[model samples]
Target: MKDKTLLFINGDAPKSLPSPANYELIACTDGAFHYLKRMGFPLDKLAFISGDFDSHSGSDEDMYEEKFILTLDQEKTDFHKALEIIQDKGFSEVDVFGGSGGEQDHFLGNLTVAFAFKDLMNIKFYDEFSEYYFISNHFTLKGAKNRMISLYPFPSVNNITTKGLNWPLTNESLSITSRIGTRNFAVEDEVSIEYESGDVLFFAGNKEIEYPTIY
Candidate 1:
């Protein structure tokens, strides 16, 4: 069965938007709603807009009153709160846009949030350059020929093995402070990765292709 995916947009506006038809539900942070509105996105299709609404004017709030979900918690980011709402709505798969770009710290914070929820749902981030996510201990990627792939350890990951890459890893370790596997290209149509411990953030080149859902 096709996965019921949620398309969630974050604060940093994406350069391009994906078709809403591909998602079972669509949502965005209030900060992202502005960009979507300005870009002529069909706001009527959004399931809800969640955020602190600090940047929103009174008129903006009144206009989107019904769809606005005021998240007042100062401790969490809009992206984090939005994800919580998505999870509460029983969504297990999310395709995120506008998670990167803007402040670099926010990008890192977004990654941290993603890592925290990795075990709860299948979350994939799509930027202009790549689609990244926390991969399972053993993962396989298809239709990856000639595409750039990056394996980055969140702090550290150990005892990794890989195949179908130009430079493969065999029982190797990657660390944030030490060695990381980045800028590697796929040499075959399929790639396989296995690891024993810790978390690995996998990055695959952002190109349209016919591949099954493997998350």
Candidate 2:
């Protein structure tokens, strides 16, 4: 288990949570506090809630009383506000749930944050189906044999190399104007990816995939 933080937003919660040992803390966006409380979650375990509070439709003011951070920025979404707090608290690894399965616009907005914050933190968006994240320039995936891996270049990516995948890439380029890697499967227990520049979002077709520890 890793020392990461779990963040819950206004979207639906999964059937089960990740092991408690993997997370150091739990946080919620203002939009999720009431729903989580109504669903009978452990409020005492909640560290804080950060957001503008315009989307909170719950009447339980007590849930966000002291835990609320009044971020009035309208340019960013509620998830972005909460993510800023996570960074301020110095948490590098974060798994976010309830950020999808709500409004389609909100789900798309969450992707914007995921890509924007790729380099700032190790963040992943999780739903009932799968978990996805932005892969670093050079990273490795362990215990990933036969797992469906999809790599989407944000706009363009250069010099991509891969090993242990069904279709290997040797310094190939994936650009928005040209080719994009999707529905690619890992053919070995470990998959390695090396790239020079640009954002390449990776998706695992499962609940979640374990990434090798970065030193």
CA lDDT, every model vs. true structure: 0.86, 0.81
Error of 2 at 26 (Å): 1.2
Error of 2 at 188 (Å): 0.6
Candidate 2 per-residue lDDT, tens place, 1-215, comes to: 33699998888766666555567978988778767767777777788888877766656676557877889998888888888888888887899988778688988788888878887888988877667888889889897886788888888889999998878899999987899999777768899999998878887777334454333
Query: Which is the leading candidate under TM-score?
Result: 1
Q: What TM-score would each prediction reach against the true structure?
A: 0.92, 0.85
Q: How close is candidate 1 to the true structure, as a TM-score?
A: 0.92
Candidate 2 Cα misplacement greater than 4 A, ranges: 55-64, 207-215
TM-score of 2: 0.85
Q: List ranges where model 1 is wrong by over 4 Å.
A: 1-3, 207-215
Model 1, range 1-215, lDDT digits (tens) per residue?
33555555554677788888888889888888878888888888988998888888777558677998999998988888988998888888999988888888889999999999999989999888899999999999999987889999998999999999878999999999999999888878999999999999999997644443332
